[model samples]
Target chain A: QQPVQSPQAVILREGEDAVINCSSSKALYSVHWYRQKHGEAPVFLMILLKGGEQKGHDKISASFNEKKQQSSLYLTASQLSYSGTYFCGTEESTSYGKLTFGQGTILTVHP
Target chain B: DAGITQSPRHKVTETGTPVTLRCHQTENHRYMYWYRQDPGHGLRLIHYSYGVKDTDKGEVSDGYSVSRSKTEDFLLTLESATSSQTSVYFCAISDSEGLYSNQPQHFGDGTRLSIL
Candidate 1:
């Protein structure tokens, strides 16, 4: 099944912070994050394993909670370039090579 | 960035006509996937191939068929195009070395398909 993402949309100003959450009903082996711009494909951000490690790229970071089967993406000092739709893909233990993604959270960062 | 390319970057077709979208990858990844993006639906997998000639249906596979006769190419076809099929199609590739490995997928620019 596909994961559920919170905050269908969000607007932020430059240098602000925002968080997007993704939760699943089943146990997840890993969580993958991607950002898609207008008329563009989704770009990989980072992947978090079941170990619950926190990963960051530039001002963006993410955390995976194995117990809760949830993941959150954190963006700090948001820039206008960060404006896009964020999606979280989940991989279950039984699903091999099949990643289910959430509906997505639209983020608009204004200058 | 993974050397994945999708043909017919933009297309507008009439209803009931057949359409095919091609995806080619130079990375030689073992896994290739076809997904459609819409307004409410972020990205739904239509079909996928694990290797040459090995394919499987995804969640929203109805009315869509896929073929992977070669390892470098994966094709998604719509037998009869409809307005509902108008959406941006994306092709993704991933190389998972081991069963337990966590390999992220790389996507192509995407093909904008408009069915009238």
Candidate 2:
């Protein structure tokens, strides 16, 4: 099943911070995050395996909580270039290669 | 940039017509995927292939079909185009074991389809 993302939309200042959360009902093998600017394909950010691992890229970080069947993405010291739609893709136990993505969180970073 | 190219970046077709979108990868990855994006809904997998001639349906597989006769090409066909099918389509590729790891997927720019 597809995961659900909270705060469908968020606005942040250039130096502000925000968090986007994703939750799934089924057991997951991994959680992958991607960001998409307008009129472009989703760009991969990071992936969290089922073991509750934390991965970071620059000012972005994410944590996967297997027990809660959820993952959260953290964006700190936001920049204008960070504005875009973020999506979380979940890998189910039964479908190893198949990924189900959440609706998405639109983050708009302002100056 | 990932050696993935989707042909006919923009397409416009009449409803009920047959439309085929092609995805080509130069990396020779064993796994290829087709996905569609719509407002209020994230990228939904249409279908994917593990290897040549091997394929499986995804969550929203209706009204769509795929073929992978070779290693570098994966084709998605809209049996009959509909207004609801108007959306951007993405093609992704990954290595055989990358599917089980944190390996990121490489995506093509995308194909914008409009059904009139």
Candidate 3:
């Protein structure tokens, strides 16, 4: 099943903070995040593993709650460069490398 | 940035014609995936290959078939194109697995296919 992302879209000013949430129906082994610009492929942001491990971009941080089967991406001191569509992909315990991505959250940071 | 390249960056074909999209990667990642991006639907996985000749279907595998004859190349074929299949297709590769599940995926530039 695909994960659900809240706040379909958000607008923020430079230096502001925003949080995007993602939830899944099934138990997740890990949650992956990616950012996609208007005309480019989705770029890797971070990956939150079930057992409390994180990897990827330094500017953004995320958390995965294994108990709730949910994850959240936190953007602190947001910059104009953060403007893009953020996606959260969930991996179930049974689905090895496969991921089911959320609908996506559009974050637009203004100058 | 993973040395991944998707061929025919843009394509426009009519219905009923067979179309094939190719993804070539130089990273030698064990896992390769094919996803379709549509407005409001985000990216839906169609198929993924764990290794050469090791392929599996994803949630939205209908109307799509895939083949991985070698390590570097994965092919997605639309036996008979349909209007609904027209969307931006992305190819992603990841080295994540049992011991390295934290590895993030890297994507190709993507192919914008338009089936008219």
Candidate 4:
């Protein structure tokens, strides 16, 4: 099944903070996060395993809650470069190699 | 763009015509995928490949087919294009499963297709 993303769209000023959440109705084996700017392909951001791993950068981070079947992407001190849509794709243990993506969250960061 | 290239960045075709999109990768990743992106719906997987001649269907596999003749190239074909099939397509590769499943996927620029 497709994952659900909350806060369909949000506008923020530079240096602000924003969080995007993704939840799945069924159990998830892993979660993948990606970002896409206008007219560009979706770029990989990070991946979270069922073991609750949070791979992140200096400003961007993500957490996976295996029990809740949910994941969250956190953009702290957002920059203009963070303006784009974020998508979360989930992999079910039973369905390997296939990922079910969320509807996406549009985030706009202005300087 | 990690060494991945998608041909015909933009295309406009008519219904009932055959359309084939090509994805070429230099990364030599073990896994590859084809997905479609629309306004409201996020990227939806159409097909994917694990190795040469090894392909599988995805969630939105209907009306579409795929072929991986070589390790570096995966192709997505629309047997007969329809207006409903008009959308931007993306191809992604990952060093996933068969090798490592936790790796993130790298993507190509994408193909913008429109059916008239």
Candidate 5:
């Protein structure tokens, strides 16, 4: 099943922070995050496995809670380049590599 | 970006016609997937291939078929294109060695298809 993302859209000023959450009804083995700019391919951000580990790169970070089937993406001190549609993909334990992505959260960072 | 290429980046076809989108990857990944992106519905999996000649259906596979004759090429076909099938198609690849492996999927630029 597809995951659910909160705050369908968010607008933030440069240097502001925002959080995007993804939750699934079924158990998840891993959560994957991607950012897509207009007319561009989705770019991989990070992936959190079932061990409750938090991973980050630069000012972007993500956390996965297998027990709650929830994952959150954090953007700190947002930049203009961070304006894009954020998507979270979830993989179930039984699924090999099939990922069901959420509806997406549009993040707009203004100057 | 991954070494994935999708041919005919943009296409327009009439209803009932057959359409095929090609996905070629140089990464030699073990798994490949086809997905369609529509407004309000992020991305839905259409089909996936685990290896050459090994493929399976996904969440939305009713009017689609896939083939993986070689490790580097995966093809997605719309048996009979319809207006509802008009959307952006993306081909993703993953290097997961096994079913339980945790690996990130890299996506292609995507093919924009319009059916009238």
Candidate 6:
């Protein structure tokens, strides 16, 4: 099943903070965050494995809550470069590589 | 980048015609996936393969088929194209069963296919 993402879209100013959440109906083994610019392939951001691990890249970080079957992507001190659509993909308990992606969250950061 | 390439970056074909999009990777990764992106759907998985000749359907598998005959190539075919299938298709690969299950998938530039 495709995960559910909160705040379909958000607008922020530089140096602001924003959070995007993804939840799944089934147990998840891992959660991945990616950013896609207009008309481009999604770029990897970070991956949070099961067992409550937290992962981050640059100013972007994510946490996975096995109990809730959810994950959240945190953008700290957001920059204009962070403007893009963010998607979260999840791996179900039984599948290894198969991923179901959320509808996506559009984050717009302005000056 | 993972050295992934998708053929015919842009294509426009009539309805009811058979169209095949090719995804080639030099990384020899064991996992390959095909996904379609639409306005509100984000990216929906059409199919994926764990190994050569081992493929499986995904949530949006209807009207779409996939093949992985070799380690370097995966193909997604539309038996009969339709206007509903017009969207951007992406091919991705991962080296470690995808970042511990939800591993980061390295995506190709994507194929823009339009059914008229």
Q: Give the best candidate by TM-score.
A: 3
Tens-place lDDT per residue, model 6, B2-116, is 8999998999999999999999999988888999999988899899988899898898999999998899999999999999999999999988743345456899999999999
lDDT, model 5, position A30: 84
List, in the given order, the native-contact fraction of each candidate.
Answer: 0.52, 0.83, 0.77, 0.71, 0.79, 0.81
Candidate 3 vs 4: which has more DockQ:
3
lDDT of 6 by residue, A1-111 (tens): 889999999999999999999999999888889999999899999988877665557667777889999888989999999999999999898866788889999999999
Ranking by DockQ: 5, 2, 3, 4, 6, 1
- On a 0 to 1 TM-score scale, where does candidate 1 land against the true structure? 0.94
User: Best DockQ goes to which candidate?
Assistant: 5
Query: Tens-digit lDDT track for model 4 on B11-73?
Result: 999999999999999988889999999889999999998899988899899999999989899
Give lDDT tens digits, candidate 2, residues B20-42: 99999999898999999988888
Show where candidate 1 strays beyond 4 Å. A53-58
Candidate 1 DockQ category?
A: medium
Docking class of 2: medium
Cα RMSD (Å) between model 6 and the true structure? 1.6
Residue-level lDDT of model 3, residues B9-116, one tens digit each, is 999999999999999999989999999999999999999998899999998899999999999999999999999999999999988766334688899999999999
Q: On residues A25-48, what C-alpha lDDT tens digit does candidate 4 reach at each position?
A: 888888999999998888888889
lDDT of 5 at A53: 59
In candidate 3, which residue ranges exceed 4 Å CA deviation? B99-101
Sliding window of 10 residues with minimal summed lDDT for model 2 chain A: A50-59
Any residue pairs clashing in model 1, and if so which?
none
Q: What are the clashing pairs of model 2?
A: none
lDDT (CA) for every model shown?
0.90, 0.90, 0.93, 0.90, 0.91, 0.90
lDDT of 5 by residue, B1-116 (tens): 68999988999999999999999999999999999999999999999999999999999999999999999999999989999999999999988766843777889999999999
Off by over 4 Å in 4: none
State the displacement of the C-alpha of residue B26, model 4, in Å, after optimal TM-score superposition.
Answer: 0.8
Measured against the true structure, the TM-scores of the candidates, in listed sequence, are 0.94, 0.95, 0.97, 0.96, 0.96, 0.95
Task: Please write out the lDDT profile of model 3 over residues A57-107, one tens digit for every residue.
Answer: 877888889999999999999999999999999989888888899999999
lDDT of model 4 at position B70: 91
